[model samples]
Target: MAEISREYMEQVAQMWNARGKGLITHMALEIENVSSEGVRVRMPFNPDFCVDKDQTLLHGGILTALLDSVFGLANFVTIKGISSMATLDLRVDYLRAARSRADVIVNAHCFRKTRHIAFNAGNIWFDGHEDAEIARGTASFALTRGDTSLLEAMTKGKAS
Candidate 1:
Protein backbone atom coordinates (compact mmCIF):
# COMPACT_ATOMS: atom_id res chain seq x y z
CA MET A 1 0.00 0.00 0.00
CA ALA A 2 1.16 3.50 -0.73
CA GLU A 3 1.92 5.83 2.11
CA ILE A 4 -0.97 8.11 2.99
CA SER A 5 -0.48 11.69 4.13
CA ARG A 6 -1.17 12.38 7.77
CA GLU A 7 -3.14 15.51 6.93
CA TYR A 8 -5.28 13.60 4.46
CA MET A 9 -5.93 10.80 6.90
CA GLU A 10 -6.95 13.27 9.56
CA GLN A 11 -9.27 14.95 7.12
CA VAL A 12 -10.99 11.71 6.31
CA ALA A 13 -11.17 10.73 9.93
CA GLN A 14 -12.73 14.04 10.79
CA MET A 15 -15.16 13.61 7.97
CA TRP A 16 -16.06 10.22 9.38
CA ASN A 17 -16.67 11.79 12.77
CA ALA A 18 -19.11 14.35 11.49
CA ARG A 19 -22.51 14.11 13.18
CA GLY A 20 -24.32 13.81 9.89
CA LYS A 21 -21.82 11.39 8.41
CA GLY A 22 -21.59 9.04 11.34
CA LEU A 23 -23.45 7.72 14.33
CA ILE A 24 -20.40 8.21 16.56
CA THR A 25 -19.96 11.92 17.09
CA HIS A 26 -16.40 13.11 17.62
CA MET A 27 -17.37 14.98 20.76
CA ALA A 28 -19.05 11.86 22.14
CA LEU A 29 -16.31 9.61 20.80
CA GLU A 30 -13.10 11.55 20.71
CA ILE A 31 -11.10 10.28 17.74
CA GLU A 32 -8.03 12.16 18.79
CA ASN A 33 -5.80 10.78 16.07
CA VAL A 34 -5.91 8.62 12.99
CA SER A 35 -3.36 7.49 10.45
CA SER A 36 -2.83 4.65 8.05
CA GLU A 37 -1.60 2.68 11.04
CA GLY A 38 -4.35 3.12 13.62
CA VAL A 39 -6.89 5.27 15.44
CA ARG A 40 -6.99 6.48 19.04
CA VAL A 41 -10.42 7.27 20.40
CA ARG A 42 -11.54 8.40 23.85
CA MET A 43 -14.91 8.26 25.55
CA PRO A 44 -15.61 9.74 28.91
CA PHE A 45 -18.03 8.38 31.44
CA ASN A 46 -21.26 10.33 31.37
CA PRO A 47 -24.01 9.68 33.85
CA ASP A 48 -26.40 10.76 31.12
CA PHE A 49 -25.24 7.94 28.91
CA CYS A 50 -28.13 5.56 28.33
CA VAL A 51 -26.13 2.39 28.77
CA ASP A 52 -25.24 1.91 32.41
CA LYS A 53 -26.12 3.57 35.69
CA ASP A 54 -22.59 3.74 37.07
CA GLN A 55 -21.28 7.21 36.45
CA THR A 56 -17.65 6.23 36.83
CA LEU A 57 -17.43 3.03 34.82
CA LEU A 58 -18.10 2.68 31.12
CA HIS A 59 -20.57 0.14 29.86
CA GLY A 60 -19.34 -2.91 27.98
CA GLY A 61 -21.79 -2.14 25.20
CA ILE A 62 -20.37 1.37 24.94
CA LEU A 63 -16.92 -0.17 24.72
CA THR A 64 -18.24 -2.45 22.01
CA ALA A 65 -19.56 0.57 20.08
CA LEU A 66 -16.19 2.18 20.42
CA LEU A 67 -14.53 -0.99 19.21
CA ASP A 68 -16.85 -1.31 16.26
CA SER A 69 -16.56 2.33 15.24
CA VAL A 70 -12.79 2.42 15.42
CA PHE A 71 -12.45 -0.84 13.55
CA GLY A 72 -14.79 0.30 10.82
CA LEU A 73 -13.04 3.64 10.57
CA ALA A 74 -9.62 1.98 10.45
CA ASN A 75 -10.74 -0.34 7.71
CA PHE A 76 -12.23 2.55 5.78
CA VAL A 77 -8.89 4.31 6.08
CA THR A 78 -7.10 1.27 4.68
CA ILE A 79 -9.14 1.66 1.54
CA LYS A 80 -7.72 5.21 1.34
CA GLY A 81 -11.34 6.35 1.32
CA ILE A 82 -14.84 5.05 1.74
CA SER A 83 -15.87 1.76 0.18
CA SER A 84 -18.72 -0.70 0.29
CA MET A 85 -17.21 -2.73 3.08
CA ALA A 86 -19.70 -4.01 5.62
CA THR A 87 -19.02 -5.66 8.93
CA LEU A 88 -19.95 -9.31 8.60
CA ASP A 89 -18.86 -10.17 12.10
CA LEU A 90 -17.22 -8.65 15.15
CA ARG A 91 -16.08 -10.55 18.26
CA VAL A 92 -14.60 -8.93 21.35
CA ASP A 93 -13.28 -10.35 24.60
CA TYR A 94 -13.39 -8.06 27.61
CA LEU A 95 -10.66 -8.77 30.09
CA ARG A 96 -10.66 -6.19 32.89
CA ALA A 97 -13.39 -3.69 33.57
CA ALA A 98 -12.61 -0.09 32.76
CA ARG A 99 -11.45 2.16 35.55
CA SER A 100 -14.58 3.40 37.24
CA ARG A 101 -13.31 6.84 37.90
CA ALA A 102 -11.99 8.07 34.57
CA ASP A 103 -12.26 8.39 30.86
CA VAL A 104 -11.50 5.41 28.62
CA ILE A 105 -9.49 5.13 25.48
CA VAL A 106 -9.77 2.75 22.58
CA ASN A 107 -6.80 2.24 20.30
CA ALA A 108 -7.64 0.26 17.20
CA HIS A 109 -6.11 -0.62 13.86
CA CYS A 110 -6.40 -2.86 10.88
CA PHE A 111 -3.47 -5.10 10.02
CA ARG A 112 -4.50 -5.81 6.46
CA LYS A 113 -7.61 -6.18 4.40
CA THR A 114 -8.33 -8.29 1.38
CA ARG A 115 -11.13 -8.31 -1.16
CA HIS A 116 -13.44 -9.52 1.56
CA ILE A 117 -12.09 -9.85 5.10
CA ALA A 118 -10.46 -7.15 7.16
CA PHE A 119 -8.32 -8.13 10.13
CA ASN A 120 -8.19 -5.75 13.12
CA ALA A 121 -7.05 -5.55 16.74
CA GLY A 122 -7.21 -3.06 19.59
CA ASN A 123 -7.39 -2.49 23.35
CA ILE A 124 -9.17 -0.33 25.86
CA TRP A 125 -7.31 1.89 28.28
CA PHE A 126 -8.45 3.66 31.35
CA ASP A 127 -6.79 6.58 33.18
CA GLY A 128 -3.55 6.09 31.19
CA HIS A 129 -1.93 6.07 27.79
CA GLU A 130 -0.90 2.43 27.91
CA ASP A 131 -3.50 0.09 26.51
CA ALA A 132 -5.21 -1.96 29.22
CA GLU A 133 -6.02 -4.53 26.56
CA ILE A 134 -9.48 -4.80 27.96
CA ALA A 135 -10.56 -6.33 24.69
CA ARG A 136 -9.20 -7.48 21.33
CA GLY A 137 -10.60 -9.18 18.27
CA THR A 138 -10.85 -9.45 14.48
CA ALA A 139 -13.67 -8.43 12.13
CA SER A 140 -14.84 -9.97 8.91
CA PHE A 141 -16.11 -7.40 6.41
CA ALA A 142 -17.22 -8.13 2.89
CA LEU A 143 -16.66 -5.64 0.12
CA THR A 144 -19.82 -5.02 -1.74
CA ARG A 145 -19.75 -4.62 -5.49
CA GLY A 146 -22.05 -1.60 -5.60
CA ASP A 147 -24.34 0.57 -3.54
CA THR A 148 -25.70 -1.08 -0.45
CA SER A 149 -27.45 0.17 2.67
CA LEU A 150 -24.09 0.82 4.26
CA LEU A 151 -23.22 3.32 1.60
CA GLU A 152 -26.70 4.75 1.73
CA ALA A 153 -26.40 5.11 5.46
CA MET A 154 -23.08 6.81 5.03
CA THR A 155 -24.61 9.12 2.48
CA LYS A 156 -27.65 9.87 4.59
CA GLY A 157 -25.60 10.23 7.72
CA LYS A 158 -23.42 12.73 5.93
CA ALA A 159 -26.31 14.55 4.34
CA SER A 160 -27.82 15.39 7.67
Candidate 2:
Protein backbone atom coordinates (compact mmCIF):
# COMPACT_ATOMS: atom_id res chain seq x y z
CA MET A 1 0.00 0.00 0.00
CA ALA A 2 1.19 3.51 -0.75
CA GLU A 3 1.65 5.93 2.12
CA ILE A 4 -1.23 8.37 2.42
CA SER A 5 -0.48 11.73 3.95
CA ARG A 6 -2.39 12.64 7.10
CA GLU A 7 -3.27 15.97 5.56
CA TYR A 8 -4.89 14.30 2.57
CA MET A 9 -6.84 11.96 4.81
CA GLU A 10 -8.14 14.87 6.83
CA GLN A 11 -9.25 16.60 3.68
CA VAL A 12 -11.12 13.51 2.59
CA ALA A 13 -12.87 13.32 5.93
CA GLN A 14 -13.86 16.95 5.73
CA MET A 15 -15.24 16.55 2.22
CA TRP A 16 -17.25 13.51 3.22
CA ASN A 17 -18.76 15.32 6.18
CA ALA A 18 -19.47 18.43 4.18
CA ARG A 19 -21.75 16.56 1.80
CA GLY A 20 -25.07 18.18 2.63
CA LYS A 21 -28.59 16.71 2.49
CA GLY A 22 -28.15 13.30 0.93
CA LEU A 23 -28.21 9.67 1.83
CA ILE A 24 -24.57 9.88 2.87
CA THR A 25 -25.33 12.77 5.19
CA HIS A 26 -28.39 11.04 6.51
CA MET A 27 -26.30 7.97 7.23
CA ALA A 28 -24.12 10.08 9.53
CA LEU A 29 -20.97 8.01 8.91
CA GLU A 30 -17.83 8.45 10.93
CA ILE A 31 -14.39 7.66 9.65
CA GLU A 32 -12.55 5.46 12.09
CA ASN A 33 -9.45 4.61 10.06
CA VAL A 34 -8.17 5.64 6.62
CA SER A 35 -5.13 4.80 4.54
CA SER A 36 -4.09 3.80 1.05
CA GLU A 37 -4.86 0.24 2.01
CA GLY A 38 -8.49 0.83 2.99
CA VAL A 39 -10.98 2.64 5.21
CA ARG A 40 -13.07 1.72 8.21
CA VAL A 41 -16.31 3.53 8.96
CA ARG A 42 -18.96 3.38 11.63
CA MET A 43 -22.67 4.06 11.20
CA PRO A 44 -24.53 4.53 14.41
CA PHE A 45 -27.74 2.56 14.76
CA ASN A 46 -30.55 4.58 13.19
CA PRO A 47 -34.10 3.60 13.82
CA ASP A 48 -35.11 5.18 10.54
CA PHE A 49 -33.12 2.50 8.73
CA CYS A 50 -35.09 -0.28 10.31
CA VAL A 51 -38.04 -1.89 8.58
CA ASP A 52 -39.51 -3.55 11.62
CA LYS A 53 -41.54 -1.75 14.24
CA ASP A 54 -39.12 -2.91 16.94
CA GLN A 55 -36.29 -1.08 15.08
CA THR A 56 -33.85 -3.76 16.19
CA LEU A 57 -33.61 -5.51 12.84
CA LEU A 58 -31.89 -3.46 10.22
CA HIS A 59 -33.12 -3.25 6.64
CA GLY A 60 -31.03 -4.96 3.99
CA GLY A 61 -31.24 -1.91 1.75
CA ILE A 62 -29.45 0.16 4.35
CA LEU A 63 -26.64 -2.39 4.56
CA THR A 64 -26.30 -2.39 0.78
CA ALA A 65 -26.19 1.39 0.66
CA LEU A 66 -23.58 1.46 3.39
CA LEU A 67 -21.36 -0.94 1.50
CA ASP A 68 -21.68 1.04 -1.72
CA SER A 69 -20.80 4.30 0.00
CA VAL A 70 -17.77 2.87 1.77
CA PHE A 71 -16.57 1.25 -1.41
CA GLY A 72 -16.56 4.67 -3.03
CA LEU A 73 -14.50 6.01 -0.17
CA ALA A 74 -12.06 3.14 -0.50
CA ASN A 75 -11.60 3.92 -4.19
CA PHE A 76 -11.17 7.61 -3.49
CA VAL A 77 -8.35 6.96 -1.04
CA THR A 78 -6.56 4.38 -3.15
CA ILE A 79 -6.86 5.82 -6.63
CA LYS A 80 -5.19 9.09 -7.48
CA GLY A 81 -6.04 11.84 -9.97
CA ILE A 82 -9.65 10.85 -10.28
CA SER A 83 -11.88 13.67 -11.44
CA SER A 84 -15.06 11.62 -11.04
CA MET A 85 -16.26 8.07 -10.55
CA ALA A 86 -19.50 6.21 -11.01
CA THR A 87 -20.53 2.76 -9.91
CA LEU A 88 -20.48 0.51 -12.97
CA ASP A 89 -21.48 -2.64 -11.17
CA LEU A 90 -22.34 -3.72 -7.65
CA ARG A 91 -22.96 -7.05 -5.96
CA VAL A 92 -24.05 -7.53 -2.38
CA ASP A 93 -24.77 -10.59 -0.31
CA TYR A 94 -26.74 -10.69 2.87
CA LEU A 95 -24.90 -13.15 5.07
CA ARG A 96 -27.33 -13.08 7.95
CA ALA A 97 -30.09 -11.12 9.62
CA ALA A 98 -28.92 -7.79 10.95
CA ARG A 99 -30.76 -7.71 14.25
CA SER A 100 -28.74 -5.59 16.56
CA ARG A 101 -29.10 -2.11 17.98
CA ALA A 102 -25.32 -1.71 18.05
CA ASP A 103 -23.58 0.48 15.57
CA VAL A 104 -22.58 -0.96 12.17
CA ILE A 105 -18.93 -1.18 11.22
CA VAL A 106 -17.70 -1.47 7.63
CA ASN A 107 -14.20 -2.02 6.30
CA ALA A 108 -13.56 -1.58 2.59
CA HIS A 109 -10.58 -1.64 0.23
CA CYS A 110 -9.80 -1.06 -3.39
CA PHE A 111 -8.14 -4.26 -4.51
CA ARG A 112 -7.57 -3.32 -8.13
CA LYS A 113 -7.16 -0.13 -10.10
CA THR A 114 -6.39 0.74 -13.64
CA ARG A 115 -6.38 3.92 -15.68
CA HIS A 116 -10.15 4.00 -15.92
CA ILE A 117 -11.58 1.56 -13.43
CA ALA A 118 -11.36 0.46 -9.82
CA PHE A 119 -12.60 -2.61 -8.00
CA ASN A 120 -13.59 -2.72 -4.35
CA ALA A 121 -14.78 -5.17 -1.74
CA GLY A 122 -16.06 -4.74 1.78
CA ASN A 123 -17.85 -6.40 4.66
CA ILE A 124 -20.12 -5.13 7.38
CA TRP A 125 -20.98 -6.33 10.86
CA PHE A 126 -22.44 -5.08 14.06
CA ASP A 127 -19.81 -3.46 16.26
CA GLY A 128 -17.76 -5.95 18.30
CA HIS A 129 -18.81 -8.94 16.21
CA GLU A 130 -16.13 -9.33 13.60
CA ASP A 131 -16.72 -13.06 13.35
CA ALA A 132 -20.24 -12.54 12.17
CA GLU A 133 -20.56 -10.42 9.08
CA ILE A 134 -24.09 -9.38 8.20
CA ALA A 135 -23.30 -8.28 4.66
CA ARG A 136 -20.53 -8.42 2.05
CA GLY A 137 -20.18 -6.56 -1.22
CA THR A 138 -18.03 -6.08 -4.30
CA ALA A 139 -18.21 -3.28 -6.82
CA SER A 140 -16.59 -1.83 -9.89
CA PHE A 141 -16.35 1.87 -10.60
CA ALA A 142 -15.71 3.73 -13.80
CA LEU A 143 -13.10 6.36 -13.14
CA THR A 144 -12.34 9.52 -15.03
CA ARG A 145 -8.82 10.73 -14.32
CA GLY A 146 -7.74 14.30 -14.84
CA ASP A 147 -5.51 16.99 -13.44
CA THR A 148 -8.21 18.09 -11.01
CA SER A 149 -9.25 15.44 -8.57
CA LEU A 150 -12.71 14.57 -7.35
CA LEU A 151 -11.87 16.20 -4.04
CA GLU A 152 -11.11 19.46 -5.78
CA ALA A 153 -14.23 19.21 -7.88
CA MET A 154 -16.37 18.62 -4.81
CA THR A 155 -14.74 21.02 -2.42
CA LYS A 156 -14.22 23.83 -4.87
CA GLY A 157 -17.20 23.26 -7.16
CA LYS A 158 -14.80 23.02 -10.07
CA ALA A 159 -16.08 21.35 -13.18
CA SER A 160 -14.34 18.11 -13.88
Candidate 3:
Protein backbone atom coordinates (compact mmCIF):
# COMPACT_ATOMS: atom_id res chain seq x y z
CA MET A 1 0.00 0.00 0.00
CA ALA A 2 1.23 3.50 -0.78
CA GLU A 3 1.20 6.33 1.69
CA ILE A 4 -2.22 8.00 1.69
CA SER A 5 -1.94 11.68 0.91
CA ARG A 6 -3.44 14.01 3.49
CA GLU A 7 -4.83 16.23 0.74
CA TYR A 8 -6.38 13.34 -1.15
CA MET A 9 -8.02 12.15 2.05
CA GLU A 10 -9.72 15.47 2.52
CA GLN A 11 -10.91 15.37 -1.08
CA VAL A 12 -12.28 11.90 -0.53
CA ALA A 13 -14.20 13.12 2.47
CA GLN A 14 -15.74 15.92 0.44
CA MET A 15 -16.60 13.50 -2.34
CA TRP A 16 -18.12 11.05 0.08
CA ASN A 17 -20.43 13.71 1.49
CA ALA A 18 -21.32 14.79 -2.03
CA ARG A 19 -22.85 11.36 -2.48
CA GLY A 20 -25.65 12.49 -0.21
CA LYS A 21 -26.13 15.81 -1.97
CA GLY A 22 -28.54 14.50 -4.59
CA LEU A 23 -31.91 13.00 -3.66
CA ILE A 24 -31.17 13.00 0.04
CA THR A 25 -30.32 16.66 -0.32
CA HIS A 26 -33.61 17.27 1.41
CA MET A 27 -32.31 15.29 4.36
CA ALA A 28 -29.71 18.02 4.85
CA LEU A 29 -27.03 15.56 5.83
CA GLU A 30 -23.63 17.13 6.42
CA ILE A 31 -20.19 15.71 7.11
CA GLU A 32 -19.38 16.58 10.71
CA ASN A 33 -15.95 14.98 10.84
CA VAL A 34 -13.66 12.63 8.96
CA SER A 35 -10.51 10.64 9.66
CA SER A 36 -8.79 7.56 8.32
CA GLU A 37 -10.43 5.56 11.06
CA GLY A 38 -14.04 6.74 10.61
CA VAL A 39 -16.56 9.33 9.47
CA ARG A 40 -19.40 11.14 11.20
CA VAL A 41 -22.44 12.72 9.59
CA ARG A 42 -25.35 14.81 10.77
CA MET A 43 -28.83 14.67 9.26
CA PRO A 44 -31.01 17.55 10.19
CA PHE A 45 -34.62 16.70 10.85
CA ASN A 46 -37.38 17.72 8.54
CA PRO A 47 -41.06 17.45 9.34
CA ASP A 48 -41.66 15.89 5.93
CA PHE A 49 -39.67 12.83 7.01
CA CYS A 50 -41.92 12.04 9.94
CA VAL A 51 -43.35 8.57 9.76
CA ASP A 52 -45.67 9.02 12.70
CA LYS A 53 -47.04 12.50 12.35
CA ASP A 54 -48.46 12.55 15.85
CA GLN A 55 -45.33 11.25 17.55
CA THR A 56 -42.91 12.93 15.11
CA LEU A 57 -40.88 9.79 14.52
CA LEU A 58 -38.37 9.75 11.72
CA HIS A 59 -38.74 7.11 9.06
CA GLY A 60 -36.63 4.03 9.69
CA GLY A 61 -35.52 3.84 6.06
CA ILE A 62 -33.85 7.21 6.40
CA LEU A 63 -31.70 5.90 9.21
CA THR A 64 -30.83 2.83 7.20
CA ALA A 65 -29.77 4.97 4.27
CA LEU A 66 -27.67 7.09 6.57
CA LEU A 67 -25.94 4.01 7.91
CA ASP A 68 -25.35 2.55 4.49
CA SER A 69 -23.82 5.74 3.13
CA VAL A 70 -21.58 6.30 6.13
CA PHE A 71 -20.37 2.73 6.11
CA GLY A 72 -19.32 2.99 2.49
CA LEU A 73 -17.69 6.34 3.21
CA ALA A 74 -15.80 4.94 6.15
CA ASN A 75 -14.37 2.38 3.79
CA PHE A 76 -13.59 5.00 1.18
CA VAL A 77 -11.50 7.15 3.50
CA THR A 78 -9.24 4.20 4.28
CA ILE A 79 -7.97 4.26 0.73
CA LYS A 80 -5.73 6.75 -1.08
CA GLY A 81 -7.91 8.21 -3.82
CA ILE A 82 -11.40 7.98 -5.21
CA SER A 83 -12.45 4.35 -5.06
CA SER A 84 -15.55 2.25 -5.61
CA MET A 85 -17.15 0.17 -2.90
CA ALA A 86 -20.58 -1.37 -2.46
CA THR A 87 -22.32 -2.58 0.63
CA LEU A 88 -22.47 -6.33 0.56
CA ASP A 89 -24.41 -6.67 3.78
CA LEU A 90 -25.88 -4.23 6.26
CA ARG A 91 -27.61 -5.16 9.48
CA VAL A 92 -29.25 -2.36 11.41
CA ASP A 93 -30.86 -2.59 14.82
CA TYR A 94 -33.21 0.19 15.64
CA LEU A 95 -32.96 0.46 19.38
CA ARG A 96 -35.42 3.32 19.46
CA ALA A 97 -37.18 5.65 17.15
CA ALA A 98 -35.39 8.94 16.51
CA ARG A 99 -36.95 12.05 17.93
CA SER A 100 -38.47 14.15 15.20
CA ARG A 101 -37.51 17.81 14.78
CA ALA A 102 -34.10 17.01 16.22
CA ASP A 103 -31.00 16.39 14.19
CA VAL A 104 -29.70 12.82 14.07
CA ILE A 105 -25.96 12.12 14.19
CA VAL A 106 -24.28 8.98 12.89
CA ASN A 107 -20.68 7.91 13.45
CA ALA A 108 -19.32 4.99 11.46
CA HIS A 109 -15.95 3.33 11.87
CA CYS A 110 -14.13 0.96 9.56
CA PHE A 111 -12.82 -1.58 12.02
CA ARG A 112 -11.24 -4.05 9.62
CA LYS A 113 -9.95 -3.85 6.09
CA THR A 114 -9.03 -6.87 4.04
CA ARG A 115 -7.61 -7.11 0.56
CA HIS A 116 -11.04 -6.93 -1.04
CA ILE A 117 -13.51 -6.01 1.67
CA ALA A 118 -13.97 -3.61 4.56
CA PHE A 119 -15.93 -4.12 7.77
CA ASN A 120 -17.72 -1.27 9.48
CA ALA A 121 -19.89 -0.49 12.48
CA GLY A 122 -21.76 2.61 13.49
CA ASN A 123 -24.15 4.22 15.96
CA ILE A 124 -26.79 6.90 15.60
CA TRP A 125 -28.16 9.35 18.09
CA PHE A 126 -30.04 12.58 18.16
CA ASP A 127 -28.19 15.84 18.74
CA GLY A 128 -26.82 16.42 22.26
CA HIS A 129 -27.12 12.72 23.27
CA GLU A 130 -24.23 11.05 21.55
CA ASP A 131 -23.87 8.37 24.20
CA ALA A 132 -27.52 7.35 24.16
CA GLU A 133 -27.75 5.76 20.75
CA ILE A 134 -31.01 5.27 18.91
CA ALA A 135 -29.65 2.70 16.46
CA ARG A 136 -26.57 0.63 15.68
CA GLY A 137 -25.47 -1.26 12.61
CA THR A 138 -22.76 -3.45 11.10
CA ALA A 139 -21.84 -3.40 7.43
CA SER A 140 -19.40 -4.82 4.92
CA PHE A 141 -18.41 -3.51 1.53
CA ALA A 142 -16.82 -4.91 -1.61
CA LEU A 143 -13.86 -2.66 -2.35
CA THR A 144 -12.25 -1.84 -5.66
CA ARG A 145 -9.88 0.76 -7.11
CA GLY A 146 -11.32 3.11 -9.73
CA ASP A 147 -12.28 6.64 -10.49
CA THR A 148 -15.38 8.19 -8.94
CA SER A 149 -17.33 7.79 -12.18
CA LEU A 150 -18.85 4.63 -10.76
CA LEU A 151 -20.05 6.48 -7.71
CA GLU A 152 -21.42 9.19 -9.94
CA ALA A 153 -23.28 6.61 -11.97
CA MET A 154 -24.68 4.95 -8.89
CA THR A 155 -25.82 8.24 -7.39
CA LYS A 156 -27.37 9.40 -10.66
CA GLY A 157 -29.11 6.10 -11.25
CA LYS A 158 -30.56 6.20 -7.77
CA ALA A 159 -31.66 9.79 -8.15
CA SER A 160 -33.60 8.84 -11.25
The lDDT per prediction is: 0.68, 0.88, 0.76
- Clash counts for the predictions, in order: 1, 0, 0
Query: How would the candidate models be sorted by lDDT, starting from the highest?
Result: 2, 3, 1
Which of 2 and 3 is the better model by lDDT? 2
Model 1, C-alpha of 50: deviation from truth (Å): 7.4
Question: Which sections of candidate 2 miss by over 4 Å?
Answer: 1-3
What tens-digit string does per-residue lDDT give for candidate 1 at 49-127? 4344656555677777778878887876556434466678888887876546667778889887775677788777775
Best by lDDT: 2
What is the model-wide C-alpha lDDT for candidate 3? 0.76
Question: After TM-score superposition, what is the CA distance of residue 94 in candidate 2 from its true location, in Å?
Answer: 0.4
Model 2, 1-160: lDDT tens digits are: 3677967876786676676348999999999988877899999999999989999999999999999899988888667788889999999999999999999999999999998889999999999999999999999999998888888878776567
What TM value does model 1 have? 0.78
Q: In model 1, what is the error at residue 22, expressed in angstroms?
A: 7.1
Q: Which stretches of candidate 1 lie over 4 Å from their true place?
A: 20-23, 49-54, 129-131, 145-160
Candidate 2 scores a C-alpha RMSD against the true structure in Å of 1.7
Better TM-score candidate (1, 2): 2
> Against the true structure, what is each candidate's TM-score?
0.78, 0.93, 0.82
